[model samples]
Target: MSFQQLVECATHGQTRASYVCHHLLQSGQDGSMRPVNWVRDEDEHVNAWCDECEEYLQSHGAEWNDKTEAFAKIRMICENCFETLKATNPTKELT
Candidate 1:
C-alpha cells in the first residue's frame, strides 16, 4: 500500500502512535513497542517497556523514566505497516 494509504488507515483507525528504543523496521521481541493513544488518558502514561526493560526498571526502582525522547523517535504507522512488521518479525508480537 502507498504511504498515503497507510497514514489514512492509521489515522482513521484506532491505531495510535507508538515508540520503540529501536527502529520499527528492525525485529524485536513481543511488546517491545508501546502504542500511544492521545485520546485515552489511561494510555498516555502507560508504561511501554519490554519484559527486559520492565524487569530492569523494577529492579532499579526506575519503573517510570522520561519518555519524551522515546516519543520523539516514534513514527506513526498504520495497521498494514504494523502487520507487515509483525510478519517480518515472526518472533515478536505487537501489544
Candidate 2:
C-alpha cells in the first residue's frame, strides 16, 4: 500500500499525518502514532518494534501476518503496553 493510504489507516481515516507501526497500536513518547521502520526481504516484510516487542517478535516471528493488508500497517507502543502484551501472550507468535 502507498504511504498515504497507510497514514489514513493508522488515523482511522483522519487527515492528520502521523507515523504508525504495524505490530502494537499505541503512540510513541511524542504522543503521536507513527509507522515503524520496515525490513523487507523478498516477500517477507516485517515491521520494526520497540525493545520489548522486538524481543517478543524475534522470539516468535517478524513477518507481516495480518489478515487484512490494510491493518498490516504498523504502529508503535509504549514500554508498559509491550510488557503487558508479552505477559498476556506468552505463547503468541506473529506469523
Query: Which candidate should be chosen as best, given TM-score against the real structure?
Result: 1
lDDT string, candidate 1, 20-67, tens digits: 334443333453443322221243321122344444445665434554
lDDT of 2 by residue, 22-62 (tens): 44454423354333333432323233444444544455565
**lDDT score for candidate 1 against the true structure:** 0.39
Cα error, candidate 1, residue 23 (Å): 1.4
Say which candidate scores most in lDDT. Answer: 1
Q: What is the lDDT, from 0 to 100, of the residue 19 in candidate 1?
A: 37
**Least accurate 10 contiguous residues by lDDT in model 1:** 38-47
TM-score of 2: 0.28
**What Cα-based lDDT does every candidate model obtain?**
0.39, 0.38
